[model samples]
Target: MIDLVCNVSNAVKAVDPKAKVYINIGGAVNLLYNDRLLGCIDGVLREELRSHPGPSGPEPQDPWETPAVLDTLAYSHSHGKTVLVGSRDRLKGARSLCVRAWSHGFIPVPQPAWTLGCSTPPRQFGAVAPQWLKATSKSIIRRPYTSIQYLSLFDIL
Candidate 1:
């Protein structure tokens, strides 16, 4: 998996040097510790900071304050990698988490209602939309060694 991600990233950069590759590895801190994988991608997207451990299991650790998570964020930032932390909750809860994320230097992605897409709730929550979300790009990102083109598909929720 690491090799695949690295190869894909290298292949993408071979064509469009400025294009970014962001991946969501489901908040795996161990994977974040992988320097090779870290070097390839532009950013990491953590779906939910407060993810459920599992049914009938212990609650999850606070990702924002967890030592390993903080270390991972620091490590990624040191390599010029963006770490986007997202949370799914009510408007107020989203705002709170967004603040927490920003305070820790991690970009916050608030999902009030995924069905509404990216634009509407940002305005409602008074949060600034990220650059990638604010505009469209003509540059198409393709998979490594394949013809599969992944367009800049933002605001699609």
Candidate 2:
């Protein structure tokens, strides 16, 4: 999978170096966190993984605070990738996550409502996302790569 992602990224970059390729391995759906797998990707294909390392899981350790999560943040930042964090709404300490992310030089991007939680009472579906992105990007980021390409397909751009 790492090779595939790298190869595809290399091929695309050959054609359009300006194009950004963001990676999100979502979750392993296994009995473990698969840190080694992510480490491998970061070790060899770190440059290809952009914007952020996407976090997903309902594990005991919230994705926002886990070692894997923090490591990815540092690794991505070191590689000059914009750090975007998508915290699960079900995860505890959301406000804390936001503060920690800000302190670590991360911009909090909205997770699709489906991933956050479809059952909860929806609030501020449209207004808050753009405001949050614009405010954080302007305040913290020197060069925000939280691009509209991903959101455009979903009609959220």
Candidate 3:
């Protein structure tokens, strides 16, 4: 596992020095590997790939106080870790996303604008909130909650 992580990390760095990558050993992997294995993974990271900006500042937070995927991503960027909250049930996890992000050590901040797609919904058009699209450490994503469509007329969101 350590070898694979090191090789992949090295490969990503070689491709784009600024490209960020994380080795996730959570969920099922946890069922297979114990704490010691996780520690070894951390050790490999420390020895081979240095953790940067140690304790740069306080934890990140969302300005709007809503559970948005973009905010979670922002938090991940500031912390230098890949943080993801599943979106299988967007409505169910909306606010919880913010809570989870807070617990996961992510730092949310104002982000730059992004053009996710052209909804062309007129005055009602939607996209990932501008604040959520701001720049952060490059990382993988699972789309923001704000991007979910199929709104109902009575939806109060």
Candidate 4:
């Protein structure tokens, strides 16, 4: 896994030294603790932080807030890796998203904004509340969160 991450990261960097490489390990978030893997990637995309159980009914257990995940998040921050949370469930309200982000210390990706093919800012569109400021670092959160962008692999591959 480390080799793959390093190869892809190096490939992207070779074309554009400023490129940012973010990996989506899906539910394998524990891999964030690996120093070698963390060293090669710029950030991580945590997909489907599903709040609802499913289409059928409520789940018997919810594992999103488990201590292990929380610990991994802290470790990622200490390594200077951005954690981006993504969810496709539009049923979730903006306030709920903000509360989750505030509680977990992650930047919630505005799925609606991107899904609708528009460029509405998260604050203006209500994806993020003005009062809920994002803190990239666990120790320092007074400053606003800044989005990092890099050239896509498609641009140079």
Clashes of 2: 0
Best by TM-score: 1
Flag the better candidate by TM-score, 1 or 3.
1
Candidate 1, which segments miss by more than 4 Å at Cα? 53-65, 112-133, 139-157
Q: Residue 57 in model 2: shift from native, Å?
A: 11
For residues 1-157, what per-residue lDDT tens digits would candidate 3 score against the true structure? 5555556556556765755443332222221133433322211111101011236532334343333434434433443443332222223333443344345543211111012221211123222333322434443333342321211212312
lDDT score for residue 157 of model 1: 20
- Rate residue 35 of model 3 by lDDT: 40
Q: How far is candidate 4 from the true structure (C-alpha RMSD, Å)?
A: 8.6
For every model shown, what is its TM-score relative to the native structure? 0.68, 0.46, 0.35, 0.65
The model with the greater lDDT, 1 or 4, is 1
lDDT of 1 by residue, 1-157 (tens): 8887787778768887877788776656678788888888888876556644456643566755466666777788778887776665545467676678767777766654453354423455566666664544455434321111132323112
lDDT of each: 0.63, 0.41, 0.32, 0.58
Pairs of residues clashing in candidate 2: none
- Residue-level lDDT for 51 in candidate 3: 14
Q: Encode model 2's per-residue lDDT on 75-139: one tens digit a residue.
A: 65665555555554433534444455557765544344344432222243321333422332111
| TM-score for candidate 2, residues paired by index | 0.46
Pairs in clash, predicted candidate 3 = 60-107, 60-108, 61-108, 75-107, 111-134, 112-134
